[model samples]
Target: MRVPRSAAVWMACCMALALAGCGADKVEASGTTDENGACVLTIGTLGPLAGPAADFGLSMKGTADLAAAEVNQQGGLRVGERTCHVRVSAYDTGYTSAGAANGAGEFIGQGIRFVIGPMGATEVTGMKPLAGRNDMLLVANGFGRDALQPQYPLVFHVAPGPSVWAAPIIAEARKHFSFNKVTIVATSDQSGSDIADVNEIRFTQAGLPVSRESYQRGTQDFAPIVSRILGHDPDLVDLASTPAADAGTMVKQLRQAGYTGTFCRLGGESTAEIARVAGGNDVLGNFFYYSMVDLSDPRMQHLSAEYEQIAGRPATSLTLGWLPAARALLRAISAAGTTTDTQAVAARLRQDPLEDPDLGRGVWTGQQEFGVDQEMSFPFYMGYIRDGQPQPLVRLEATQP
Candidate 1:
């Protein structure tokens, strides 16, 4: 008999609840699946550990693990009088929906109460039922709209939404490009369309008349759409896509067709590796994107140093997104003093006001004021791809969108 997605977590729920001891045993850390639930209260970050977007998942995972290590070092999460050192069960989702669903089942079987995950939209959707069934809270790192919409009460988003991103991209365009006309091209999927929605709303709101085209995620030819965009004589083109190999193909075709207008991408790919495949110089110079944090900022210099030690690479703004979300869950669990019931912690997330600097470098408010929508209140930073690297635009002052 095939178990339902939620059943896996539900079956393990009793075992997990029994196994939930708020005791701070020696903090044992390992990066293997065989070690699941070997220690009390295991938490995890699920994503590609050795796949195509491995760099993307690994960088974020490194930061999450580092955050866990830091908390555990301080004697772990304090649930009332008991201190529980967190054990992490990091899993790879292989950047596929099926892989993510299976990963969710594994974490449930391991009897985990909290999870950080599968950094893409499809993957998050795959794991949603499992999280909901277990009543376990999932802090998602991706900006997929489905996770937020249709409301996963048990799931929380740490990264700001695409709505948080769009206004800033338009604002930056005004400084660098003539704001006469614009075109937006996006994937037909939920994540892509959601980002396009933000771009369309903000583009006109920013006082620039905009035109748009929606394309399938992996379409080989954009010339037909590019032809339509060029007819508008657009000064700018917004390309919104999920991070994957297909986005690279689209970027290459756009540039190869001699489209000179600036093309700004939403969430840059794994490591600018997309640049190499998508025509390094041409693609990098014209890309406008949202980067969650700036490693160059003196404020984030500390995290940059630490990220290098942890992930073996300089931290990008996106790396900062996962840690704060994970920490938020840990904080709620600590404040509520119980792991068996996430409701108390969920209530704190709903009832209590939060202003955390580490999460998103500013004050945070939950659904109480925002109507069951806000996960964190970190402001978005406008970024551009420069010289084969992603960097902050720097000219536009930061503001909430």
Candidate 2:
């Protein structure tokens, strides 16, 4: 019999709780040792795998799996005298606080020492306490103002937040499209409000008048929100933190309402999906957005080729964003020489240079913004779409906070 999604999640959580009770003694420094004396390590991935933001979560899972596979294929990670074979366990959080909390519990019950996601702001907030208390290392992706606070030493950011990149992107967009006034649309939850708050500050500081509009999550018909947004008579509309699917629907509705304005998404990368959802590239005329990775780079191309070889399909730009952090986690574990002691792993991660063969080099930033230098800041792309055709992406260097 086919089980309902919610039922399946509930059953999984229950099983995890039972396991926590039964396996308390079995939990050790890391994974089990094989007959060949190889350490088998399991890393947990927490994210939404069955919701509007599933695209981002699935990308996170894919990249983490790829990182693990790469390590295993290279004869596993060498930690002192032992070899470690990495494995990945993924749990879908459904992009909710309760889901994230439950997913964290599942990981804890399974004795997972490291985790790779819980990308949304709410998901990060929900999972942080449990992960901190259990001494789990997290390479998280979230845009909340407190996503990388000093209190959470084990938590590290996968990418810099809008506070670091938004101003530069806004300046670049102004060069191509003139816009004096902006309307920002996002969801009504913390994830939306947090990112929208940052974007508003950045836009206002750039001397542009800004207005805000929001809708309840899971609202399929965006006609009312579109009407409200159009009432502001904006020259530019910024989809601050809307999921790609929701942003696509909003783009379609706004277009149908006869609003001819430039569009910008200063949040996550989902341009292709957004364009597809908005009908076609032509419908997304004069659009600007952020790309997590610059695909034009030959190194990035090689990374894509490697992913296609391993995953049997092309990797999305979003998936590429998670690669560096996932790979870094394994390297840190090797450097620390212990998978169980996350504190040591975090230390090694901070000391090591944030460099990747395919993605290039990054810096450990966020000290100025979050009072901790745990966020990874990589060079990203500011992409433009004009008259429904994509323009050559403008590569931007990573900026310091």
Candidate 3:
């Protein structure tokens, strides 16, 4: 027998309450009706707006703003019998733990109920308490596995978690090139280490031998790390979830070292920025990343044009997922018929999968990994870069293994 979506959501919530020891009543959404009787919903964007990761924060904020504008232009979202408009408030967290706390504080102060991002491990953990306290629904694009529990049930992850991405990335590697052995170069931080560890396990599971190396986060000179990675003389070099600048620098140094092997960045975003930093496409040789989207689709083309018109530049992979996240939140709110009940929105999200325009079909299910069911699983796009130009190849469906 087919189970009802509401029944599934109710069971998930009950399990969360029992396991997370978190009170659903602690935080409350504070949406208000304007004098015009239209529901006014405020959403927040928390990320690095001032530091080295500012580009990522700005792109997230810009894409979110565009999504809101598009919704408002369409006469607003339907919330029960009324129409609702969205207001996006962005905070510059400097990509630090303290900044994340401060941004969360600001959101709480303004009674913001929905948030887009605050990428990275440290920042997401820092914002968890505030998110829980404020009863806000946070849709983050970072590594949220460690922070996800019944305690922070409001927090949702849009990116692939743990074992999910490994199979597809490995399969793509073998298909794109004849790569059997791999070497990993990741930042020596909690986030990078977690990703690298997962990659190691997944590669091993896929019957591929892997070697791993790490460098400090701010190391601009990647020669030392690149030298160590190349020492393995592996057929593939995995830049495991490195930031844009660092990954680009590593790519440049690897090319200069005459390492003509395949280059793969598991968390691929901001390809144009990486290409520019790597001193052009010639240096970015035989690159493979897992974050490409079909921009040629009319819906995507329209979104991209709108984003470029608003952001004052072209949209890259980094900006692609924000719209889907925003749309999903709206979808949840409409389904729940109320924005004040954050859990209701989350419940609706878990039960009903959305046809995401950018990320393809997506569903929320993480019962096996995280104790809670909040991770959004989707078929991510894979791309191939030859000489410098990236071409979107096909959708890679994640596997259970």
Candidate 3, superposed: residue stretches over 4 Å from native: 1-39, 50-52, 80-82, 357-359, 387-392, 398-401
Report the lDDT of model 3 for residue 324.
Answer: 62
| Model 1 CA lDDT for position 43 | 75
For model 2, what is the error of residue 293's alpha carbon versus the real structure, in angstroms, after optimal superposition? 1.1
Q: Which residue runs of candidate 1 sit more than 4 Å off their true CA positions?
A: 1-39, 48-56, 142-146, 149-151, 207-233, 267-271, 279-283, 351-354, 357-371, 385-392, 395-401
Clashing residue pair totals per candidate (backbone < 3 A): 2, 0, 0
| For model 2, the run of ten residues with the poorest summed lDDT | 20-29
Q: Name the runs in model 2 displaced over 4 angstroms.
A: 1-30, 34-37
Weakest 10 consecutive residues, lDDT, candidate 1? Answer: 23-32
Tens-digit per-residue lDDT, 1-401, candidate 1: 33322223222332233245322232223221333433245677888777446766776677576566656555455565456666777888876678788888887787776777766677777888877877767777566646554356777766655556566666765675554777877667665666676667777788878777776644666677657766777767766654545555556776676766666666443436556667675574566666656556665676566567655776655666455566666666665666666656675454323333443344443343224554665655566654445555453332344
Candidate 3 residue pairs in backbone clash = none
Top TM-score model? 2
Q: What are the per-residue Cα lDDT tens digits for candidate 2 across 16-135? A: 433443212222244567688668888888888876788888888888877776666566665645677888899989888899899989988988879998888999999899999999
Error of 3 at 350 (Å): 2.0
Clashes of 3: 0
> What's the candidate order when arranged by decreasing lDDT?
2, 3, 1
